[model samples]
Target: MSSKFKKRLKQLHGSREKRRRQSTQDEQSRVFTADDVEEQDLGIATSAVDAWRDHGADSRPTARGEAHFLVRHHPQSHQHGTKRLAEGAAVTLEGFRKQLNDARLHSADPSRLVFLDLETNGLSKTSFPFCIGIGVWEGSQFGVYHYFTPTEADEPASLSACAEILRDCEGLCTFNGSSFDVRMLQRRFSHYGIEHPLDDLAHLDLLHLARKLLPDRNGHKLSQLEEDVLGFGRTDDVPGAKIPGRWKQYLKTGSPHLLLDVFDHNRLDILSMVVLLPALAEGLGSSSDSARFKNRASKSDLGNRPSSSGSDQQARPPKAKPKTKLASQLSRTYALRKKAQSGGRRQPETRPTEQARQEDVPRETVKLAGSFSRAKLRRGMPIGTRLRELRGEVERLEREGRGDEERDEIVHRLHEMVALSPRNPFALERLVDYYRGTGDAALADHFAKRLDETSPF
Candidate 1:
């Protein structure tokens, strides 16, 4: 007989109806219900034009009779960056072919490649992609075109718009489109009975290559690389996990205001890949190229950036920054904050993760984190415990005549080790011998000084 008991009983089976609809159209007019909102067949016929009418100015129907919602960076006014993006894109295609182990991808021309990203409701048959972002070379410039679905009825239109534009391109590129985005599109197309043109197109999913290239990055999420390695972070951006909810909010309220955040989020994801792809491809070509890429990413030379988040921030993940011993970088981060505070603007809050990124040491740390550094090889082995292990990697390279860049990077690691354990003498003597062989008596003397400092003899 209690009201609380009755409410609990009402929610148990979702037997209570949320909304009622009168049919000027076929839509159920029902809002989200406990059982109805699950990603399954809603039994609503999405293909018919009679189901939905314009709710207001913000919600309208596209010419194709699909729901239309978020569109941004319209290619008409969007400009191409000054960098030779065509060359960069082509090189990126080659890198993809190398990593994906697929010869079929060669059919994709670098001159006509397209970058693709999608925001979807969920991964169920009824779940749909609400927004699609595609970046293509337009005339002399690279432009990004956005296609969005306004309602469940609009999903097909968004995909149709996307397919029509992409039909002309030689291939497609995505962050991790291989496993999720592309596959989802293909499935939806199959369900809709439309021919999926992308089926035969070449795809270069950067996610897989990112794993091979940035093993030090841990989980390999796009956001992590967006800050630490790419040196471009977002401000006031929506966390990716919340993206689906943003779309659902618009769906229920018919307000397009917050969708702008999704537009910005999609825009940045596309542009970052455009900028980052070439820098990464160039590294795959050679060791020197890798060194140069490290320098560019570390510096501000790779300039395409996203809006960074504001003062309300959380602690950044550990190992996000490169393991360098520079104290000056930390000092500079504080100086920038003090400057901001004095200017009357809210000072950007610094998290522990921000320190290394604020240091912005450069791409060499990214490259080092991957395969060519002593950091991964040096985990937890002390100078006393693993002098052999300490010298194992660099010694192999030296004996094989294989390490040109490896030698330069290893010497820094050796210096750190010798600093930590001068008494061991093994690392110090090797440094002296290595520096002397390389004809740097000044450097050799530096290690010898440590040796002398550590021992009386």
Candidate 2:
């Protein structure tokens, strides 16, 4: 027998013994019937409890059992990065309702509206949440609370604690909670056989609302909005993917150190929602109300803005920055990166004449890539060739299951095709379908009307 074969046999024998021991333990611990009122309190080691306490979390008794959580109260004068959590207190209820498009929020008390964010082990139904971060308005200050699950067994206690806080709130605000957090919590509550407290609350999902109202943002992610809209940025924050592993590590090693960053990440997410609500409401407010909010925001933001020689234009609305140069650079980079990422796709070859023609077109005169200007339209690029190329690109993108990722590019090309050939029913029909699918009734109706106008009965 070879040495390698002998070692492999020993490893397999050891694993078999381990499994046998686990099965025996399971059999011995099995219970025949469930008892609802009886609590199986598994006490964590004193060292582990002390470690978590050192990081600001303390063990508290909930209706279900003992849960570990942290609570911090921020004074009204305290600012989170560049924006004050107090600014959210200034949000008009009507404007906020308009921003989220939920009438129920119009009558809801602002102080009772809670910002919720969760840290979970994974996205699957089988996955468990380890932390729940909540923000609530208390008197004249804001409060941030985090409920922690020490183990999978502690989930019931943590959820109970979270529900107790949520019970007092009339409205819930979350970044992308509609698709993930809310569903996750519902599943968890169902799993634990507990009544859900969030069912009757006015849910304001900021993700979809942000995309609709702030279309010019680079991205609508909580972190992105925190930087772009709230003017707040995090340093040394933990990536969400690694959070599950941190919990597992703590479970194995009995060390709570890895979880410190996880708590910070959750805390920042809740705090950002505190400011993002008012910022988004400012855009969705009526004209006069919007102007008032903007003026207040601008005044508060004066410290971060560059000092102007003349203060006369202090109240003037910020002007849109030119995007000609940025658009050109982004277009080129996108093409190159797309080709690189799609390993099978080869770069298209261009003729010297075509290159020279592109160079001769002045940068200042260049329009957004897909949308053409009249000056560029005058140049003799064959309409048929461009249309064929665009159709081919769309087909390729759809074939590769990237239709959703590149839908905007596809729509832009379809519009260009229609522009070049006004009677092109195919492009016009596609435009109508695309808009309708995306829930844009106005654009869909306009395109449908155009499709009918171009059709020959």
Candidate 3:
């Protein structure tokens, strides 16, 4: 019985080994069918071949055929095509003048602006363009072109094509292209011995205008700008840094799947540029109007309330009134404050009447006083004591009814106090309220601007 049991175990082991051998042989002998060949052709996995056959049998052949035909016929077309397009598409001298004229007349140019964006290998002088994307606006109709290095050896051709497109522009626009993009292009052209066309082009970089017009929010990224200004968003886009990896993947596997997303990202960048240009123009126009109105109002106020010794001076205007200097300084200060407050949840505060009249105190004196006030507060100084000191100083200034210089001196001191302890919003707000109460719009605006910057209302 023991012998029989041993024999039975040996037979089972033999059967198991046979089955394993058969499975290995079957896997090895698996036929390379048409599906496998097609999968190989499309750079798809063998397992995916079945799905392709099930769903894409008809479409695959047509796409493959077309791709092959295009590649075969235009062996060097991607490289040469770009160059041809650039040279062919360049705007003539006459065309440039015409577009500018149209822009002046209608506040818009009808030449169908081309928004250009490129993703490069890096941000250094040695960086080269791995791909280029262009979005052409032809009277509300949008066309996108994405050109990439066809082969490791075909970079020049691709770059040349890019140059051609950039050269033939009615109006060229970019986001931060002035500092980074255009400079990179110029370097690339020099390296490749190609003529840089962007040097002579009339281009507007949105970054400069953005810095000038928009509040200095942290969201200066192109993606952020697109979301905020253009009301557009993208998904499945490749991160800019991962572009090199995607290119390497395409080279290794001959799969352009990742490249498709890169193309989409580039196209979106161009479209965002298209949208941003007009929005920036509108912002600039609005800022210009506000500046003009402020200037006129400041001049009118100065004229109406001329100082006793300034009537004859006002008659001659003394080349220019000092009001312009005051107005300009106030405007700059206010603008800076407003920038700091943008996208923040703070409103400007009003100043107290007494503080407004106490504009004769020197800045150093107020700073020293505020420091003492803070130290005393920390040491359990009563709030009334602090208030009394400030009120006494303000009362003394009010009785004197000092000159403009004295008033400015007091305002300057208050500003220092506000700066040292932004938490003490009351002081800044009271100053603003005082300026408003005295009908000093510029001074009021100045405080208002500070409140905007630092207030947490």
**TM-scores for every predicted model:** 0.50, 0.57, 0.41
Alpha-carbon shift of residue 249 in model 3 (angstroms): 2.7
Each prediction's Cα RMSD? Answer: 20.8, 17.3, 19.3
Residue 147 CA displacement from its true place in model 3, Å: 1.4
Tell me the whole-model lDDT of each prediction, alpha carbons only.
0.62, 0.73, 0.54
Off by over 4 Å in 3: 1-112, 138-140, 286-457
Residue 156 CA displacement from its true place in model 3, Å: 1.3
Better of 1 and 2 by lDDT: 2
TM-score (C-alpha, index-matched) for candidate 2: 0.57
Which predicted model would earn the best lDDT? 2
Clashes (N, CA, C under 3 Å) per candidate: 12, 0, 14
**Candidate 2 regions off by >4 Å?**
1-47, 288-457
Q: Specify the poorest-scoring 10-residue window by lDDT in model 1.
A: 48-57
